[model samples]
Target: MTGETAPVAARDEADPVAVIEVQAAVLTRNFELLRRRSGFDSQLDRAGYLLLLALDSLGPSDIGTLAAALGLDPSTVGRQVAAAEGKGLVTRNPDPQDRRRSVVTASPDGLARMAELSVARQRRTTKMLAGWSVEDLAQLARMFTRYNEEVAHHYFTGIDQVGCAAPHDQPKHSTAEDDS
Candidate 1:
């Protein structure tokens, strides 16, 4: 459902679980839209763009390194690199240190296209957050960074140990008469 029409449970804004759920939904939808706009729906799939970006940032890297940087499987990154190579957006070269492994890097054309896309994306993001005050933007950045770090820590450790209890296990904080 669209955010405007979605039914929200009657819960206080201070309720951590409810706030997290709503924010997660909002961020997921926004990221999906951003992904489509950033060429995921076109010739460059999300994997390709991400792979190219990683290559651009990290220079030539083997499949395993790229996969680890992008939090993807090596096989998946290999496929993405192959597809990007087919599109002339990236090139694979023999790793100097490892004869059996290949290192991937963004091609000149890919670099140029990536620069153009980055500018466009920056413009889009600026426009999207034009209504927000500087403080709000800063707060969002800080909060998002903290949230991501927490998620990553939990993922690396055990999420079950992070106290992400099931919904049914949560204490009932809402009263029937308070349904909004």
Candidate 2:
């Protein structure tokens, strides 16, 4: 980041792939900082946000199912679910089929909170890209989605609909580790 960066929407034709990687790493750290300093006192933390998001998309599910969807360990998901439940953001009820297991679901209150958090984040992002055109914003979103998919492909095994390997099946190229 010492020298002049490439123009917006432009790639540096001269830099090697390693240089791009380094820049990407810096960009992620910078984005994290931006999120932290955005002056929004978000009620939902990252774990809770992600958990609700997964539950919203997947419907009510057992902790193990939610954990798999979120790419988190069940223990970690359990702790998060507990915290959210304490906040009235989520609930865990006895699974109908299996009386011993609890199924976690995002409460209506949780979804409302999540929506507010999402709007706040989106506002911050819109402010940051104030001058960007709609087409540019779309392109940026597409590129980021592509990059995220590639990252998940290499690091996670249980991503659905991407033809990724199942939990017990490991792809040769993926040395699975929870880098997050």
How well is each residue in 99-174 modelled by candidate 1, as lDDT tens digits? 8999888999887777776677778888989999999988987787677545544332211221221112222344
TM-score of 2: 0.78
RMSD of each: 9.6, 5.1
Per-residue accuracy of model 2 over 1-180 as CA lDDT, tens digit each: 876556333255467775666678779877787668764436788788888888887889888887777666789989999999999999999999999999898999999988898898998789989999999999998887777556555655455432222454343363346343
Per-candidate TM equals 0.72, 0.78
Clashing pairs in 1: none
Highest lDDT model number = 2
Q: Show pairs that collide, candidate 2.
A: none
Which 10-residue span in candidate 1 carries the lowest summed lDDT? Answer: 158-167
**Model 1, stretches more than 4 Å misplaced?**
1-12, 34-40, 156-180
lDDT of each: 0.69, 0.76
